[model samples]
Target: MGTFRDAMSYPLLRVGLIMLILALLISIAGFYRVNKTYSASGTLGEGMHYLGDDKFENEYLYHNRTLVLYSSNANLSLLQGAEMTNYTLVDREITLHPEERPVIYVFNGSVNYTYNATAVDYPYAVYSLFAFVLMLVGVVMAFLGYTQFLRDVKEGKK
Candidate 1:
């Protein structure tokens, strides 16, 4: 349509379109990046052992038939050692797959045990949220730009 073509001549509209494209690409990357790993849930106090200070004052260990996990905190010993509290652990492939001693730890669930784990040095959900916000902003900006273009054309300023 002529109206669409005319609006495409607007500079702000072009910038907004570029922003939208970038946001889409970023969101796709985030989606695949998130799917590359998985999460596991379990009770904290079941089969966990207090390692009694290997590198820190409070260190613990958990293991199953397939994987081994070691968690440490300055105050981890304060919690009940064998209480039936729930927890979640992410896949080791996401944390440090290439290293000889890849770090494995438990995370958010029914327990307050905080594990400062990293996925390539950054959190995936936070970055994905930022990309989503960016996409929303881009959409709003594009709408505004199209409306401004229409107004300018109506006022014979285009």
Candidate 2:
């Protein structure tokens, strides 16, 4: 307790503590966001109905300027002139049926559009993983700093 108190008095230790706290908070928030997005996206996907027509309009919304489209059917195609850029297609095995496995189309686009299909899970998952890693690093660093401070205190007292 004395060592901890002395460590807390140091400016560097204080800054490290603040950083650790912030990292923990960010990681928690990121995880919560990811969980919420997954639940919401699952609900949306379950409720989604297949459009009989090839042409459809949909909207994707997120804090960042990006959109994701998910569909079980591989026969679908995005119409031209949607102004989408850097599009990438990823195969996601969320469904039991191989043929109905979800294909995710990710790209940067405005949230103000209608689409036939859309997904909101992938981006949040990615963000959550990143934050989790950051939190792990911060925790390790804080622990090491605390131990080092304790060692220094013991040496000085000797």
Candidate 3:
């Protein structure tokens, strides 16, 4: 149809297609990086972002120049302004309990702290979520552009 033909030249449709491609690339890269785990061993000083009530909920740690999250049910009072020496950080999947969900483990030469994810993989989930949103926006934009172009063609404007 002439309407469909005219719609092919819609500028917004082209922009939406480009965004869709970019979103796909981002999602693929995010997935690849999120699955990969890592480990590090060093001395960590102090904990930030403490979320707990009586019992320990979660906290952020700076390990090896990377910000990571460590969580536990018990009150890890030692993490407050205390330097954790000879600490070993192990990512999920290769942890002692491989069957459990994705998480990171921190062994402070004495106590063990479990984290939701590693610094390398944690932020990728947010990136992937953003990519998904981009994909949705692209789809909507492409559809709107095509329809608008078709409407213009119907009115003999194209």
Candidate 4:
């Protein structure tokens, strides 16, 4: 009991709290930017249309569903699922819901591609699910590091 309270007496705990809040704020910012209404500029290279193996066959669309990138604080991975109703002049932005997670489907006649997403009941793809778990681990590590630093300071016999 005394040790835990003593650990909280250091200033680093305050710093940790600030950092944790900052992380959450940054997460919210990212969530907002991605969920905004679709714009023409953002759509130009995001998706492409292609015909089946034979040009005369039916056409299919390929979307850039995901990208995994690292940031200063954490690794950020994005899986975008779009629902397109019309072929030309696409209308209504399609979003991949958490429930859909990862689905097996052919994109632009490519069978190797897969759909992986975040916040799903069941994660169908390995990479998509790994990223989310990574983020959660990072959060836990940050808290542990912060608290550890504070504990070390409070225990110093100065």
User: How many clashing pairs per prediction, in order?
Assistant: 0, 5, 0, 2
TM-score of each candidate structure, all chains considered together: 0.41, 0.37, 0.41, 0.25
- As for lDDT, the candidate ahead, 1 or 3, is 3
Off by over 4 Å in 1: 34-124, 155-158
Angstrom error of the Cα, residue 122, model 1: value is 9.5
lDDT of 3 at 49: 27
| Pairs clashing within candidate 1 | none
Query: Which candidate number has the best lDDT?
Result: 3
- Give RMSD to native, each candidate: 13.2, 13.8, 11.8, 17.5
Candidates in descending TM-score order: 1, 3, 2, 4
**What lDDT does candidate 3 reach at residue 54?**
18
Residues 18-128, model 3: lDDT tens digits? 789989998877654323323433332344322222111122222222223332322223243333222233331112322112222333322333333232334455588
Alpha-carbon shift of residue 24 in model 3 (angstroms):
1.1
